[model samples]
Target: MKRVLLSAFSLLMCMSASAGVTFNPDKVKAVYIVRFANFIHWPQESSLKQINYCVIGNNQVTNLLESILVQHQVRNIPVVFRQVNNQEELDDCQLVYLTPESCRLGELKIDRLGLVTVSDERAFSESMGMVEFREKSGRIVPVINVDNVAKNNITIRSQLLRISKIISTPQGVEHD
Candidate 1:
């Protein structure tokens, strides 16, 4: 397990180093989110036969994720990447990486979807998505909203939550 963690970390570093000025930290962070998926446990009878990582807009994150996934397998399943043009496509993904541009599709009702949605926008409130990634002290970390995750039926591992910077919901509401 340590070896896998080390390998994953090494891959993350290499990706960050290789990312040019055009690459956004959010994109790099999105790649980290993809790595976290490996540690999660989905429902046993999930219709998803493969682990799908979808990017909602044109970004370097998909390329970075592809390169990293090529070297490693998640839960013994091959990781696949897809670029989504619409909400219909998003439904097929296990994790959806949404750019600021894609967030405008609020009418798509993505917040209520079962797939995990990740973004960099601070405007993403508790009702907007499950988790948001932020850059702190030169490192990217996830700010998970457990309530939203539970609403979507996504199971996040305790270990991942321990390291994450959790974002709390409104008063009187508890997160799973």
Candidate 2:
């Protein structure tokens, strides 16, 4: 099993390299968001035609995400990119990538809409987002606030939870 998995990963890396995608932080961040979408489950009644991958205040990452989406699908659902401009535009987004400048849009409204928020912005998971990507020792670490995920009625598979840094509370206080 391990050998098969390793082989598949190697083949994927080779394909990525051949496709002109060199390993970089921006590309990694975009890939991470795409992978996260596969591991999270939205509410059952919220039918999806395509996964709406939204980005705010960053076009470079958005472009990178667009490239990755061309080769992948979230749970076999087609992904469409949306470069969002404001909070109101996020209503139908299933996944969102935010920068610190656009972090203000990572509000309770996102949770209510069942959006899986991922960001590299510091303290993003502690504030209102579900996942924050932090760089540690030359690797990007995903910090996840499972509480926020649950509040949004989304279920992240335990396999993903096991690999992430889990925090149950935000700001050292439990949610009311």
Candidate 3:
């Protein structure tokens, strides 16, 4: 009986590991944002004619995100990946993943556009949208800035809201 219990425990551990996000903590958070993209609704005027995923300043995370997104389709749209060097390239992206080093540039662009911005850094909070990842009690969890999202005219689905730790902000304070 003890041997059987041990086997069961081992099985549980393996399953738990497999069930968790596959990338490293930071990269997993970026991938998580990719998944979150499916749950957001852009205004009719929003430029979603093509689904583009941009990565700024962190090639590693971009590579991992590309691998993950390759297997999934969003709104029947094929995902396209791009590495951005400047804010001017941001206009075509529906989702932008910013590394710590590029957070300021991303923030500046997101503030001017209605694009979804995600980052693993705290400085991202000043942007129009953010998907902040943090390690808590040895686990990685996403904290979403729904207020920022709304400010950008991006609507987050209720289901995603339920699963994420949402950061609330006052209504009407969100700039266009």
| Candidate closest to the true structure, highest lDDT | 2
For candidate 2, the lDDT comes to 0.72
TM-score ranking from best candidate downward? 2, 1, 3
- In order, candidate lDDTs are 0.67, 0.72, 0.64
Give the poorly placed runs of model 3, Cα more than 4 Å off: 1-23, 45-47, 104-107, 126-128, 169-176
- C-alpha positional error of residue 105 in candidate 1 after TM-score superposition, expressed in Å: 3.7
Please provide, for model 3 over 1-176, each residue's C-alpha lDDT reduced to its tens digit, 9 standing for 90 to 100.
33443353344323334467343564545446666766887674244556778888865767777766663557766667778877789888878888777765534556534577777776345344467766665556567776677777888888777756776554323231
Ten-residue segment with the worst summed lDDT in candidate 2? 1-10
List model 2 lDDT by residue over 83-151, tens digit each.
Answer: 887679988788888876777554435657478888888888887888998776545667888788888
**Candidate 3 TM-score to native:** 0.73
Residue pairs clashing, model 3: none
Name the lDDT of candidate 3.
0.64
Residue range 1-176, candidate 1, lDDT tens digits: 43765675656545543355243574457457667775565653255567777877765665676555654457666567777788788767777777767777676667644577777766463556777776776567677887777777778888878767776566324334
Candidate 2 residue spans exceeding 4 A from truth: 1-23, 104-109, 172-176
Ranking by lDDT, best first?
A: 2, 1, 3
- Count backbone overlaps in model 1: 0
